[model samples]
Target: MARGPYEAAIPAKIADVDPQIDSRTQSLVEAATVEMVRFDAELGRDSAPFAALLLRSESASSSEIENLTAGARKVLLAQLGDRSSVNASLIASNVSAMQAAIGLSEDLSVENIGTMHHALLVSTDQGIAGEYRDRQVWIRGNSPHSAEFVPPHHGRVMDAMKDLVAFMRRDDIPALTQAALAHAQFETIHPFADGNGRTGRAIVSALLRAKNVTERVTIPVSSGLLTNTRLYFEALGAYREGNVAPIVELFAESAILAVDHGRLLAADIESALRDYRERLGATQESVRKILELLPREPAITAEMAADSTGVSTATAYRAVQRLEEVGILSPAGKIRGVRVWVAADIIAALDDFAARAGRRSRH
Candidate 1:
């Protein structure tokens, strides 16, 4: 049954997950779940802006894991329809994928997984957008013979995926435990040709939302993974060795870290917006509207602001100029003759979030 440099890993036995986790592991999961619940409740119904921020952070970190790096400024610019770097496009695709995953959280299935994958690659590569790979795939090397890990052959991918989907739907295990297992299994399947890692991470976020561990906030788990990239990969390897505890522990710890980091970010943004509003000192309606929109979009163009606020182009320009004068926004240079403005404080907070998350891994 064994194949390539790896042991036989197909037909993932996810249905029969281990029932008894140690008391310590259970305690960790419980504490992490509590933190996640608290984080979600604090965001409440008006969480869209914070959710967008966290998801962007998640997308950037997840893509970085694949060695695709893009800074917050470039990503925020891309969100405003600016022409950004190639890596920004890939990270933007990841953001779309995360959104798709959230939408599909209510029903986790093989077909929905395909839809998420399609959303991820549709903007970049059309050929392998939704379909599972039809040929063999390997990780970290050019060929299966020399790869660090060769997944199951192409013929067995769908069967393995089916098993994983079934497991994802089960409620027997703790949510974190189930998410960890499902992620490991999906990575083992390596269903897609080029986006398995990002997709797998998306599944983790989807599982959290689906299970109500997080209602409106997508805990920045990738930020935690980026914190210890080696440990994350090592946990995946440990899962392959029939030691699921490592990955489960990693997920639990990551959830805790994400909640802590998210709290700091939420505070920073609230303070920044307060400072901006105070500085403006009862601004015009149009300018105030733009301020409301900035949390969800740290970067904007006059056209984007006008479209979002249903105002004239000239009005939008005036509002932008007012905000710029108050130093609430700064011009981030021109993109194709159109001006782009960035909320510098928000971008700085996001960059700091990413830096703190990745700092441990660099040491």
Candidate 2:
């Protein structure tokens, strides 16, 4: 097949990035980092609930950027092993990818990036999982001739990714700055046949963790980017044009927004748990364990409760009944005659967080 002229323009190598930024931008990055650190500290060591919420929010928003949409209720239900629609499953895959990215943050490399991508698409498209593109690909149009952007040829993808990994290893740059460049450069490379946007965003979370800008939770930066999809794309475009400032600034602002929103979410969850405890009135061991699990698994079946809480099925069922009586867990329908219950308040909070995160930005 004949290659198009645009192939010549593909960036086959990572540019030499200047880590230095003006004082004002530096301050903004510093402020964002401070908020993230503070938020992580507040979450403490046992931050499963907050971490779950942030990961779900990030996954949902990142999927939404690719026109995949699913409601919080559906996603929560799906996570609990309920009957799931295609969109819900896709978001689930995204959550898996995000989790993998977090786990692999300690060792960032092209192979691990492929692992993240593989986790993301394995369920939906196994053929493309964990593999770089073997053919030319373009975005936003039917064909390369009319596409908004054409990535480098598949032949150059590995070299480009190697260069990106090299850039990521440098310690001189600010963490946020390195993250911004890494994400933008990954998108520019478009190493995979599909799932680039999502995989790229997942890298942001991984980078935050890798650099220790965040310790316990994955800040939902994609939620902030969801605030202005057009602007996000524009920032990527600007980066492709050799103007890296837009992406760096966008990332800093997004980090600040994510931390602020995450704190609100954490407070709400704590309040909900407190209210549940008061209503339950010094609950039994099983009930208390269920409450602890609610933050991480807002929806669950009796079987799920048993597995998670290490209780007998009957004990889990009894606890579910108690939770239901207190309005902490409401029936959310059944799957194969097995009842499902959801922490409605937690689901509502998650939905609200997703909505607010994706709300169009005024600035």
Candidate 3:
């Protein structure tokens, strides 16, 4: 069924920016933005191998998000940076839940997002992984000293969601506005027993991709929201009362910030590539040779490298090892026999960028 525009609980209007934000909060957001830009740039240029490793790990980690402790997340992230040939199946499984949630699959008949609870739980090993509440429960914050307000659900929530997906898939609304509305509506639904926050953020990514507001950039807006848990919830709560302005404005602001960060990061990468190219000088021949082999066979083995480079097996391995040492490539896993070297991080980043672009274009 087709969806249409989502209406807020109450009609709302965009707030005029207070020129008074010369205040502390504004200054802090500014500083954080700059810091984020610098970090993103630094990471972006050199991110290929690490990004691939992390994303692949993310795919695996997402499956087990319910089960992973803080320590486990740290351990998994740490171990991921220098590995390759990580199981593609594991990576695919991690994203499977998100893919299904967004209805990205060709097999639309499979199941609803409700079924993903098991996948998320199995991935995370959290006890609440697959179970839905048998009884209606009040949605409450876990903060200290807060009395929770349990709103009555008179089926408005489900109706709003069906309305929202319709809004997202429509061509009439502006992409930016549609993306924002879809996000707010999804959060308003709060359908799941747990993992709503993460799922909501993923939906934001999906909607942005669907709407074409952002291209080749994974905004990582959740990281932004994580900075102010209180304000984030407050804005979301306000949306529940039918006020769309705050959430819409918040999303627009976040999108601008995310894009600014992405641009800086992309610039840094271009700079690094230039410098790296200059340093190679005449031995640049090897770099060219490697580039030729990368697309045809990104996964390089000792024999494959030798055959591709027309160099001795030992020499090919040594060159490949040098690239790996400098963060350009890495071993897929620890089995050691027929070990494959992959440009995991860069490939993953490119893939991420492509996915983001694809989603954005769908808008």
Candidate 4:
């Protein structure tokens, strides 16, 4: 049934790539880049708080690309330190890794890539958390002979990764194109034993940050890929065949769709914020402070809110009580023993975004 294990994989040198993006694909990349800039500017315009909602969106959608599914409530609970659902915890770890990528964006080196991988898998699979594989790795089958892809040998992993990092640091390439090629090349390299897909996607996020395509908000490009993974995979396959345009075009299309969907999610968040404003007509500073924090910290405790808002525990609890009375916040069970309050509307909006992102068809 199966044949030979195949010849040793030839590692491609990709440090200096000149992608041949066609006219249509080039236009699409231009349009997508402009839309991404516009979309980021629309939502709070460089505020760190807004990044939370979309970062969660991006991470969850990215995880869903690998079939790691979790409802938004579970993910929010996990973000608030719940960690009950295995999938939710994993998705949350993906979120953490994304944050790590963004944090390490300024550096963008081989070591930081390992650090991002470590952040992603340390909690779930500590043994191989940040370490590159020392053995051959193949994809999609029981043995290398039947595998869909056999990456370069472990000995070549670091060297190829170094080349990729070098490519990532270049300024001649367009941000979207660079990110696209970098992602496909990293996937081609397949440096790590596990979590390659997620880690590779996270590096895209980092590249966007490093290139300054997005400063405070994530584009959720993976959500766009989530819509039609067949095409996405086909594009990756084409990349391996030395066709760079397909992946670049896919990233462009995904960016535009992600921007459109992100706008809808932003509308939902804006509406929730408006509802909070109406319900919080004559609140005190502490109540106002906690309310401001709700978009970023959907599931918050009184103590946590107090510490964040620089108020006493009693003041924070009173604020939570006021928000709860106004129907903006509600109890979401306890974390350890303290009752955690959640912004139900915010979580609902994010869940709706995730649902739409995961929905089939792209129009």
CA shift at 92, candidate 3, in angstroms? Answer: 11
Per-candidate TM-score against the hidden true structure: 0.94, 0.95, 0.54, 0.96
Q: Is candidate 3 or candidate 4 better by TM-score?
A: 4
Instruction: TM-score for candidate 4, please give it.
Output: 0.96
Model 3 Cα lDDT, one tens digit per residue, 34-96: 543444355554455333332332333332323321222222322333233233333343444
Candidate 2 runs further than 4 Å off: 1-8
Better of 3 and 4 by lDDT: 4
Cα-based lDDT for every prediction: 0.87, 0.87, 0.47, 0.89
- Order the numbered candidates by TM-score, best leading: 4, 2, 1, 3
Deviation in Å, model 3, residue 7 alpha carbon? 23
The alpha-carbon lDDT assigned to residue 207 of candidate 3 equals: 59
Cα lDDT of candidate 1 equals 0.87
Error of 4 at 109 (Å): 0.4
lDDT measured at residue 21 in model 4 versus the true structure, 0 to 100 = 81
lDDT (Cα, tens digit) per residue for candidate 1, span 189-234: 8899999999999999999999988888799898888788889999
For each candidate, C-alpha RMSD in Å? 2.6, 2.0, 11.1, 1.6
